[model samples]
Target: MTAVHVTPTEGVDQPTVLPASRRDVVLSYIALTKPRIIELLLLTTVPVMFLAAQDVPPLWLVVATVVGGTLSAGSANALNCVVDADIDQLMRRTSRRPLPRHQVSTNGALYFGLALGVVSTVWLWTLVNPLSAMLALAANVFYVIGYTMILKRRTTQNIVWGGAAGCFPALIGWTAVTNELAWAPVVLFMVVFFWTPPHFWALAMRYREDYAAASVPMLPSVASSDEVSRQIVIYSWVMVATSLLLWPYTGWFYPAMAITLGIIFLIEAYDLRSRARDTEDLSIIKPMRLFHFSNAYLALLFVAAAIDPFVK
Candidate 1:
């Protein structure tokens, strides 16, 4: 294949030539999937499967669910890249993504994403269960059509509600085990639902100018620092409380981990709120401290949940 040079367009600050190398093309397609975000989604997934089984789930079942979930998540993220391509070029944080960098054509990414969605549905229905497949498909549709197309640019509460799409992995994981829903998975789902805003708002706080430039209405971009931090504290408190609701399903070990992790998460949230209350300076607010800690908090909490059954 020959290298393709794309002319710089409006909203795109730099023109980039697509490399002809097969490896680069493959990697560009992978980048369209936003693999890091998929990792976080999967972290919530596999643990729930373990919790549902209350033992090691069949290795093959675990592998099949992971593969299906990856493809489903990749489809959603890739389509999001396609839809957000124009604004992505305007935002410094997203300018390097494959769509904005001209590494993948819009139509190419769109078709690839659609294809992944189809394959994931079929794969999950055949290998995991029909219910898991349906849940995964719903999540893809919600993330792309509901969140990316509808809510993201229109409202400051985009992440708060749109983040529900991300919460489906917990449901998918649970359904993949029992072919149905339960209060346990529902609680975990809400934990992730509440966790999403504070986690994303913190990152948005750091990239407020990026979202503002992109004309996206992320809360942190449009709201006052005090308002954003206050919202974070509020959501953080709710997320921690929701997490403890799982204590009824798990043993004492899980609650101990949940309480300790929740306390730390709350401290970081309150600290961010405290700093924001003191001043408007982004440098002093340090929202990313809470942002990074939130990642660790979610991962460790889920791991503890997965371990609780065995220890009990």
Candidate 2:
């Protein structure tokens, strides 16, 4: 006699899986928020707050700003994931993102994003102030729906104009501490705004093919590497020059740090230029190294500003 075995999945209309499925879903939800970028974004704000306060900010206020900013940024990223899901599917770098990987449902991601945005707004308004809350809200709207969706697909100048999205955090942090905007924080805001293009175009040069494949119109993809390289160098110089101006508002510590960091940024851009001029496959080693260092450099430069307030 022969016996027939029935498949468990065959009997059920909806599939059942082990516990890992649920855990993965939870993890996917978190990844949809792009935590690394949020961390870097939050880091930009802290030093500004410390400097604006002329020392360190209040402990409770610092905590509130960080938490509120993170939530708003995370919410923006989630919405970004939702809107850019199509382009994201094409880019190797973005292929693993939550929506692209089908790890998070688009509707679920959108709803979660809106909910986080609401919570962040409420929290910041209550704890920080209405102005700080407004700044964060504007940033979220600008980054996710504005840059990632509208401008990113439309033009190479996207990041340049879109740079304003990231600048708001400095404003938010400044207002969080001072409760008013000033020339000093405005300078900080412009520093980050100008820094955005070169920092990103460096990465874009490295990922030109990915941007091309996705039709994402990164500056490097739209321009010859030489043009991209030149722009990167120009922006790096401007960032360093602007950074030096902060010395008048702060002190010797900032100017000193500015020189050291500026030279390094110039050297990195020069290397990128030389490599792009010489290489066929578009050597990214130089740009990749610059991109990595630029992250630390900007944060450290800003940190120096905060410390300068107390420097003896």
Best by lDDT: 1
Q: What does the lDDT read for residue 96 in candidate 2? A: 65
In model 1, the runs with Cα more than 4 Å from the true position are 1-13
Per-model TM-score versus the true fold: 0.96, 0.91
Q: Note the residue pairs that clash in candidate 1.
A: none
lDDT for model 1: 0.91
Over 278-312, each residue of candidate 1 has an lDDT whose tens digit, in order, gives 68788999988999999999999999989999995
The C-alpha stretches of model 2 lying farther than 4 A from their native spots are: 1-19
> Residue by residue across 1-312, what tens digits does model 2's lDDT show?
011122222222222222258888888889988889888888789989988999878999999999999999989888888777776666667766776555667788889899999999999999999999999999998987678767988988999988788889889999999889988888878889888988898888777877887678898888888788888888888888887777779878888998998899888888887777755465444677778988988888888888988997
The candidate 1 region of ten consecutive residues with least summed lDDT is: 1-10
lDDT for 49 in candidate 2 is 92
